[model samples]
Target chain A: MKRSLLPFFAGTATGLANGLFGAGGGLLAVFLLNRCGIDKKSSHATALALTLPLSLISAIILFCWGTTLPLGALCIAILCGLPGAWLGTILLKKISPALLSRMFGIVMIVSAVRMFLR
Target chain B: MNLIALGIAGFFSGICASMGIGGGFVLMLYLTLLAGTPQKEAQLFNLCFFLPIAAFSLWRHRKNGLLCTSPIKPALLGGIPAALAGSLLAAFLPNAQIAKLFAIFLAIIGIKTVFARRESEQSKEERVIRPTQKQ
Candidate 1:
């Protein structure tokens, strides 16, 4: 396969997963981009960029399908999430790449187990 | 309904966003399993929750020169359709099936994570050894 096409394929797969599961696209993207020869931090950043469009498209689809959530809950969650995300980014900078990768793995495993048990 | 739970979910999701990963899963699971929201609805809510976080994280990453923009266009092109299709499928799928699939997805990611970590460790060891060997 052409190297240039790698992002396309990776995006499609991640998008599909994001659309279906409403999460984990960035996780998958990080892994794929890393394999495609990007550095760990860059992969993470790139994944974030890619995630925006994918989530937007998928969110719109779900919304149009009549998936309605409580307005108040949504408001509270966003309010908290913004700061949380900022904190995470700071932590990302302080942490070593190796440690970050490990954290990523731990999160994946924990998430998998949680989903399994649920 | 629980304000504390909502805050916790958002905070964690934000952290994940900063790491350039999607924390939407955490938000979705929290809402569905703990907060008593329906599965499909929880997913939708989670999506909305992360939009701002993703945008914020991306902007920061770009400003810091961490973001590699080269692959974004192709990714967007390929991802949009897939996302649409996946969304449509999830909308119609039964909750049980979606739950089962979610479990499978998590498990796969977990397994991959383990392997990825190992591979990274091994490569680091190689880089160290190769330099010493050339000395």
Candidate 2:
């Protein structure tokens, strides 16, 4: 495949996962972008950008489906989440790669176990 | 078994994500393990699939009074530009690294959930409302 094609494939996967999971798009986007030859800084920025549109689109769909939600609570969460997200970004830089990877693995396993148990 | 299965997955995933637990872990696993897709490909498919579902869920929440633009707006300031850049960056990576990273992220979420207390199970933090002094 041509070098340019590589990015498309990478984008496709990142986009697919983001659309389906509604989480991890940021982290995974960076990983894929980095692998695709994008520098870390650009990859990080791009990954961060993806979150808004993806979340917005998902939120809209939920609305159409008529799922009940806590506007107040979500608002609080969003309010908290922004700072949390910003803080999280800063914190990520402080962690070692090994520990960070371990953290990531543990998160996934817990999520999987919970769903499986559910 | 095709579109229907996909639709159901999206719906369920949407519910979970809106609940703030994240749908990506489950979505990728289902696609890769149950549906027999390769890890890389499953992730690719799920990313696109998640967008609509998440958007709809957030919208639905707003209808139920869950929507708040307050924090989300600030996030958008940073998130939009970052995502575009990330998308562009993804074009150059190798597949193995992606898989490794995905696995790592999953592991972390799983551990946190396991040890973390459910909001319902825990006592709510008290929110203090103080009276203003008379001017």
Candidate 3:
């Protein structure tokens, strides 16, 4: 694939993943951006920049389609999430992400198995 | 107690999500498995949950000089239409089916995470070598 075309394809995949699953788009974005020769930190930040809009669009679409949102839960999550996001952004520069990434991966695998059994 | 637990989970999920890790997975897993939220509904919650957190994180990243703008335009152009299409497809699919597919996706990401080269180490190495090479 042409180097220039990579971002478009990456966006397509990221959008598809986000829209379909309501999550995971950033992971795809980061991976594709890395493949596009972006450094890890930039890839992560840029992925956020990419996925943020995509998620907004998807959320609106999903809501209009009559997906019942748990507004109370959302409020709680967001309220707590704000500070955490702040901390995460700081940590992004201060800490090495390799260990956390692997830990998160392990947690994801465990969660996946649990979901399968449900 | 439940609320506190949810709050804690939300905090951690926020951290991961902001970092461009798959925080949605954490939130989705919590909602569906622990909170007993329906699968599709959980997805919606995850999506809604991301917006504000991402906005904040992006602002922070921009301030920190970590953001790169080069990829935004093309990606958005391709992403918007694809996102709409994918959401339409999801609307048609059964919740159980989406759940199963999500499980598979999670497992794949997990495997990749476990096995992929340590990104921070690579970046560190790059930072070390770039200036020397430029000399």
lDDT of prediction 3: 0.87
Q: Is model 3 an incorrect, acceptable, medium or high docking prediction?
A: medium
Per-prediction tally of clashes: 1, 79, 0
How much RMSD separates candidate 2 from the native structure?
16.0
Question: How does candidate 3 fare on TM-score?
Answer: 0.92
Error of 1 at A106 (Å): 4.2
| lDDT tens readout by residue for model 3, B1-135 | 178878988999999998888888788788888888877788888998999999999999999999999989999999999999988888889999888888888899888887878766767787998899779
By DockQ, the candidates rank as: 3, 1, 2
Give per-residue CA lDDT, model 1, range B11-129, as digits (tens).
88788776865577677767766777777888788878878888888777777788888888988889999999888899999876787788788778767765665556757877888
lDDT of 1: 0.79
Candidate 1: which stretches are off by over 4 Å?
Answer: A97-114, B118-135
| Model 1 clashing-pair count | 1
Residue runs of model 2 more than 4 Å from their true location after superposition:
A1-107, A110-118, B1-8, B117-135
Ranking by lDDT: 3, 1, 2
lDDT of 1 by residue, A1-118 (tens): 7889998999999899989988778888988887666777788878888888888888898898888868898888899988888787676666644455556666766766776676
Stretches of candidate 3 off by over 4 Å are B120-135
- Candidate number with the higher DockQ (2 or 3): 3
**RMSD in order of candidates:** 3.6, 16.0, 3.5
Given candidate 1, what's the lDDT at residue A84?
A: 86
Q: After TM-score superposition, what is the CA distance of residue B10 in candidate 3 from its true location, in Å?
A: 1.1
Tens-digit lDDT track of model 2 for B15-117: 3343333445555565655666644455445454444444544444444443333333334454444444443333334445545555555665456434643
